[model samples]
Each structure stands twice: as structure tokens, then as C-alpha cells.
Target: MASSSDPKLPPLMKAQFLEAFNKPYVLRSVPLPTVTDPHDMLIKVDAASYCHTDAVLAAGQMRPNPPSFPHIGCHEFAGTVVALPEISTSPFQVGDRVGVPGRAFHPCGTCFECASSPTAEDADADPPGYSVYCPRSQNNGIDAPGGFREYAAVDSRQVAPIPENLSAVDTAVLMCAGVTVYAALKRCRLKPGQRVGIMGCGGGLGHLGLQFAVQMGLEVWGVDNADAPLRLAGEVASGARVIDARNVDATEVVARLGREDGKQDRGDMGLDAVIILPESQDAFDYGVSLLRNHGKCIVVSFPERGFHVSARDVVFRDISIIGSLVGSNKLLRETLQFAAQNNVRAVIRTFPLSRLNDLVAEYHKGRGGKLVIDMALSDGS
Candidate 1:
């Protein structure tokens, strides 16, 4: 291990590790991570957000390469830098509020994706950049260790500074939900004033997507059949037309969408794009039905098996079905900045680390918002 760390820190810290597939996590006192690489930083992880990916991993459903046994969970983490690297030129400093996005880590500098860093391009080093397409990169919590502990060692190069208005709890969601939907919106390629539909609008990512879509100047329609999620959609984006897909007829939704500006346009002139978040095939098909010709259908959900879309409709309407993963490092920074300036935030319920097993048990039973583990709440909550 790298010796470059705070000598005053403790040797070990509490963490939750997935000891086996299809089993509950085990608590252990693991050695605290150290800042080894010049681009590394040791973080006192304040908050780690639970995600669907964690549920998938727990179910032994990870595709291609499986996660190692006894792996640390939680890819969406935010914290203060307790120990900084020896390198002075890094963007971060000691005590900087930061977050490491789940998908963008361990980027090989020479790759084409890393070279496409949106914010800055450097000659001597690979700038803190995107690794979404980097073949050699390791996804945090999958191929590499993640933040499910009191403290975590992270790749500083892939970390985004948290906005001052946000706490680590809120920033944790930004790492996953915010960056994810933002990247999905980018993939939609919808212009300002065009219409966009968010299929799972009441959940954590969906509500946040509504906020971001409105801020992006797109007219929004949020779809959810459940009571809790529809309530959340109304609470977060009051201006949006929140539709209950179970009750509302598709023609009515399309008609209402067409008449938004009082011009009474054709019902078939539907949304410019649809951002799908749920895993249900019915939801996917309904979302596609709401799209106009040549509309972009951006898929964000990853079910055990994929959902089916009508091939005839897709070909006839010229709809572009695209898959959007989490954003690159540069997109994470941009996403946080947007959230900070626009007051966009996640409505999260905080639980102490000790209650992780309880949360994991109920994770897929159907909830509407974000759940997070707050390290500060270590008081047996």
C-alpha cells in the first residue's frame, strides 16, 4: 500500500462488504484506504447513495465480468477529502467537498475518450476526463472497490467537487441520478422549447430529470401510475403535466401534449423525445407511443433482460432508440454546476450505516425516492 497518508488517522474503519452472491452484506472492520497514486485522495465518506445497480449485484445478475467476492458496495459516494495527494497541481485540496461518480473511473490517459475531456485539454497529463468508452477502465464497485465504508480511497481524477449549496447526502444522488439523467438528456438532443417526456418521473432520478429537463428549457410531461411518485412529480416540478399512465388514455395524453400552447396541433405531433427510467416493458412501449416522428427514445433502465419496443412503429416513425450510460467526468462537473445554480436536488431519506441490511431487504419492494446511508449517523439508527 502507498505510504502517503495522514499518520494521525486510524488504521481501520467500519464497512459493509458483500461476502457472497444472493446474500446479505456482512459488517467488518477493514483497513482504511490510503492515497497511493498522485491522482488519489483518501475521503471521509459522509454519504453513500443506494442504487438499482447494487440490487442487481446482490441478485448475482451482473453481466460479463462478475464482481469479486467480499466486494465493497455503493458506487455513489460523497465526502470531504481527509488526505490529499502529494501533487500540488490537482484541482482538489484538503477538505474539499467532492464526489466520485460510479461509472467514470480509472481512465487510461491515452484513450480517445479521455482525450475528449470537455472542460480542459492538457499536454502533459490526462485531464480529469471521461472514461465511459475506455475499454481498459475499471467501474467502481464492479471491477474495483467502492464506497460502503466510513472512509474510502478514490481516484481524485474522476471526482467532481460538490456545490456549496448541497450537502454530501444530496451530492451522492448527483453522482448517480443527476449525471445519469443529464447524460440521457444530452443524448436526446432536444432543443429548447421542444417537448420531452420522463417515464418514471416520481422516483429519485425521474423527479431530478424533470427539474433538469425544465431547466434545459424543454417543455416537460412526467408519467407515473403510482400515487407516491405522481405526488413527488407535482411537488418538484409543479409546472409539468404529471400524467397517471394507468388512468389517462394515450390519445388524451397525446392530445393534451399537442394542445399545450393552445394551438391544438395534431395529436400525433407528440414529444420530441422520451427518457425512460423504469424496467417495465409496458412503460417502455407507452413512452414510445408518446413520441413524435423522428423522436429520440433514450433508454436508461437495465432490466435482467431488455424490454421490447414495436419495430414497426420505430421504423415507421423514424424514432432513434439510444442507450445512455452515466456521464463522463466532464459531464459530472457540468451536472453538479447546473444543480447548484438551479437549486435542483434529490429528496432523500437518510439512514445510518447500521441499517443498510434493512434497506437492502426492502429496496425492490417499490419505493418512490432516494435512500442514502449517512456516515455521520453512526449512532445505531
Candidate 2:
């Protein structure tokens, strides 16, 4: 029974707990988590960040719900390996920087979803790269305890080693926010020089999506409800065309985007694709409306109710509304690497773990970039 009993590690650690719905998280001292599986490695969390889904989870509204109450608050976490389990043959060792992206934790590689080859030329494949859809899988932060705690027991197979160039905090935000939108944008399948509109293009996911779209060689027009997000998007991707919906009407925006040739005549020549990233159903309808024939409407967030997309428009216009979850393990690695090489980084405002509630309150009100709890810093800077 000689597991990772590092004397340097404390038996108990401080963790965030959402004791009840619609209440602030309470910090409690709990016993350190232990490695259960052979491949599970104990990690000392260096940083973690909250997303829009954290609020929904705290409200007790998210479906298929978290495993239990007093749930840990963040899926986006990055840290250094502190201890390795016995019998683990994985190359990972203590002191290695790594991140667990919280989706597809225990992917049964034998299942139909996981077994299906992405390189296979079978067009009838049952949806390739849906890594989170494995029937026997459980997510790190959502369906189980997340990384708000000081330490976590993670599967080595599921964790991605941090690139030498990326810090733990930047890698943390990229885990959830970056991967979600990266997956959604890829769903569009638009070739280079093609047009794609990203709804909610200024928020955390939107900003990353705009930059990724630019890197992918697509002509991206990003639309936000206000000017602040547009500013953020502009700062991230110089190639992106940032649009403020408040300043310009949606119809006019759609018309302007359609007229890529600058002719200004309103017609059916709309965007080639629209990647919807906002957590509003109205965005779904609006995204569908902005698409041309056979254009894709990639849905990313979960609104309160279902989308009110027009059936007639979907049928006649051949609008394909695709629902995307987080990206596959391979895609997540690619995003982290692409971000490192391309200088694509999240605009983060850091605070210590003590100020998580403060950030959450401000985040609920909405903001640009990602909010992070820097465990390495004592003050809530």
C-alpha cells in the first residue's frame, strides 16, 4: 500500500465548495485526494480559472449534473506533477508541468465513438472526433471533483504536458474555453478564403476562436453585443473584422458581411458559416439567419431553453446546425501547440484563490478575456 506519500505534501488542503445553489463558494480544508488508478498521478495545482459554465454549475442548473454538492468550481486547471502512482509506466514524472482539460477523462478506447478512426475514409462513420461522447467517460470538473483544490489525482493518459513556452495559467484557460471554441470553429469546415461569422466573438471563447479562424486562413467577421468585446477581439486578431451589434443592426451587419464584394445589394449571399459561441438562444437563431446556402451554424454554449431556429429556413437554405461539445484530446493538444507557436494567449486578469468569489461576481456581469485564480500568488492581484 506504499503509494505517493510524499512527506513534502500536506495531508489536508484548502478547497472551494458550493454548499448550496445560488450561493457563494465556501473554502474548506479537506483531505488530499489519492491516486485510485494505476495511471493516476497526483498534481499540485498551480492555477485554475472559472468559465460561464461554472456559474451554471453553481446555480444547480446544468444537466446530467455534477457528481455531488459542494462541487469544485473549475474545469480549467494547470499544475505540476507532485507524485506518481506505483506501476505507472507513463513517461510523466514529478515536477513536470501538465494540464487536464476535464473532458473525456476515462475514454473507453474500445467503444464505438473512441474506436472509430479519424483517418478512415468511411463517410458513414458515426461522427469522428466526438471524444467527449464516449459512453463510459466522465469529465474532470463537471461530473466529478474539479481542480479548485490544491491537488488533483489525474489520469496520465488524459493529461497534456504543458508546452515549454506556455505558463500554467494560460494553459488552464486554454483547457476549457480555448478547446470549446476551437472545436466549434472546426465544425464549420470552411476552406481558406471562405467567409465565417463568429457570433459572440469578443468573450473568452470568441476571442480565441477569432484568432484561430485567422490562423486557419478564413476571412472572419466577429460580432459582439457591445464594443468592449470587439476591442478585445481586435487586440487578439488583427485580421478579424470586429462588429458591434449595438452600433449596427443585425440585418445590416448580415447584409454588409454578405456583400464581400462591396456591392451593398442585400441578397441570399450571406456568410459561408457562422460559429455561435454565446450562451443565448437568440444567437442560434441569428447565426442561422446569417448563413448562406449549405452554411454551417456551429452551436457551442447551452442556453436556458432550446434554440428557436426556423424550420423553413433550415430546410430551404440547407443550413446545418451542428451541436459541438469540447474538442478531442488530439485537438486539445493541437490548440495548445498552435497557441504557443502563434502567440495566441488568453487576456487574463489574475487574482489569488481568496478572490475567486470577487472574480465570479464580476464575471457574471460579463467581461473580456479569462479570469484566473493564481495559486502561486498570495495576494488577490
Q: Pick the candidate with the highest lDDT.
A: 1
For this target, which candidate reaches the highest TM-score against the unseen true structure? 2
* lDDT agreement with native, every candidate: 0.82, 0.80
Q: If scored against the real structure, what TM-score would every candidate get?
A: 0.91, 0.92
Looking at candidate 2, the ten consecutive residues that score lowest on lDDT are 120-129
Predicted candidate 1 versus true structure: per-residue lDDT over 264-345, tens digit per residue: 6453578889999998898898898888778889999988789887887777778889998878666888999999998888
The lDDT, on a scale of 0 to 1, for candidate 1 is 0.82
| Model 2: residues with Cα > 4 Å off, grouped in runs | 119-130, 257-259, 262-268
lDDT for 323 in candidate 2 is 88
**Predicted candidate 2 versus true structure: per-residue lDDT over 130-162, tens digit per residue:** 456788877787877888888887777777889
Q: Which residue pairs in candidate 1 have backbone atoms (N, alpha carbon, C) closer than 3 angstroms, thus clashing?
A: none
